[model samples]
Target: MTLPMQVPIPGLPARVRIHEVGPRDGLQNEKATVPTAVKADFVRRLAEAGLTTVEATSFVHPEWVPQLADAEELFPQVAALPVALPVLVPNERGLDRALALGARRVAVFASATESFAKANLNRTVDESLAMFAPVVARAKAAGVHVRGYLSMCFGDPWEGAVPVPRVVRVCRALLDLGCDELSLGDTIGVATPGHVTALLDELTGQGVPVDAVGVHFHDTYGQALANTLAALQRGVTTVDASAGGLGGCPFAKSATGNLATEDLVWMLRGLGVETGVDLDRLVATSVWMAAHLNRPSPSRTVRALSPTHHQEQ
Candidate 1:
């Protein structure tokens, strides 16, 4: 009899919560518009496959992200799902739109690197935090849970190899601003295992609980899965991934998509960790989305497990 692949890493959680971001982060950067109905169906399928938290859409200006311009139409479709549907709000204006739409969970994105903040948000690092401060506070007062995303937590293409203290400072600020969870993002996929360990250790030293920290990684350097493993070993429970690796950063020039959910699920399952995700169903969802995007999924696991393959020119 053949044995199943099982590699147990020490001190890892028995289960992990995957925050699915394909419908939002993944689709925001697409060059083509994905219909709101298609986007809604995608989130519904993800929730049905056991992903509890799906980042539904961003309420940024339509000129900034024409792809997600239908946020108003999209939110109402998936808002009733039993899963947590968190939308990305760029500032207080975005928050107001979210509140009016009756969104119960939202996220505010910040950047650890000044270069990225200026390029992406047209503000300095401190200025962006100044922008998000009131948004997070008001959202909390309204009984909504906020997730804070710190981009370029490891390295920035403009500024190489970010220091741990810089990341910790921003993390502390976001927590102080009333964010219930922090998703530290390797926006350019420059983080390796050692960098991940040092940063997480310093977050502990700075009094941020491991449980309150999550990780978001891009596979620009193809290190997303490896970096996620390092985070998991350190007692980090929440992970951010897109179905079929369907994203790229418009600001971070060299960035690729976020880590694919299928790839992460495959590794987590092999390590004897439970994520409550149905792998086959997730893979099918990726394949379906790939057809709409007109490209083969960037996921290695999805490509390996897919029932159909389409050529990308």
Candidate 2:
């Protein structure tokens, strides 16, 4: 399939969609609980950087993720922003909390591997989907857009390698249940470019529209960028990234964080894909967020651009 416009970079399509998940996914795993004001400011800076879609926060129980305990308060403030802010809803209770905050878009998550599904959500694969059906239905009825996340799509730490057919089955179920988009996640960052290509080929061959699929890759072995390029080659426009490379999976031991948004944007721009994101602004946001966390940015682009770190003439 051809894109609406010709992309300037070789081997890249015309346009790409980036879903910035720094505030939600990135900050959630931080050792320190970021102040609500800081979180709001971090999101505002991302918006200023020209990001259209941002995952602001998750409405899961505080006990599960102490960092997002302030979701109710934070949602209203973020909801008033001018961009698309989506929150993660694990179940009907979380969905109710999101709806109470007047959220217009919410995302539901499920795992492709049975071990991860049962361990993470306390339910089997099919049982988890059954639990999500009511949440999807209610969100649709409320005129809210719902995105589905399928974790461990490429490889699972517990199960080792997940079958492509299993991933396709979950994708089909989510799409059938009225999810606007399905985000395929490499939860453990073990996906190679060839693995990505194979999965995309299989999913597309299975009749899943390329447009409805989003690729979320982790940067464990520094292969996230290459895998992202592979997805782009397959015409998957939507990509999920975290500013400053902020989050790591607790379930997957030794797993690295999500792909850095700044680095991802840089690569996309170099490939002639229009992302509408300002590199300098993103760099500034990452630096600011890193400072708040009292840690250096995990983003390579940010490190290279740091004023103090730049080589002197």
Tell me the number of clashing residue pairs for each predicted model.
Answer: 0, 0
lDDT of 1 by residue, 62-145 (tens): 888899999999999888999999999998889999999999999999999899999989999899999999999999999999
The lDDT values for all models are 0.91, 0.89
TM-scores for candidates 1 onward, in order: 0.97, 0.95
Per lDDT, the best of the predicted structures is 1
Superposed on all Cα atoms, the candidates' RMSDs to the truth, in angstroms, are 1.8, 4.0
Worst-scoring 10-residue span by lDDT in model 2? 1-10
Residue ranges of candidate 2 with Cα displaced over 4 Å: 1-11, 307-313
Q: Model 2, residue 110: displacement in angstroms?
A: 0.3
Candidate 1 clashing pairs, residues 3+ apart or interchain: none
lDDT of 2 by residue, 127-205 (tens): 9999999999999999999999999998887789888899999999998889999999998899999999999999899
lDDT of 2: 0.89
User: Cα lDDT of model 1 overall?
Assistant: 0.91
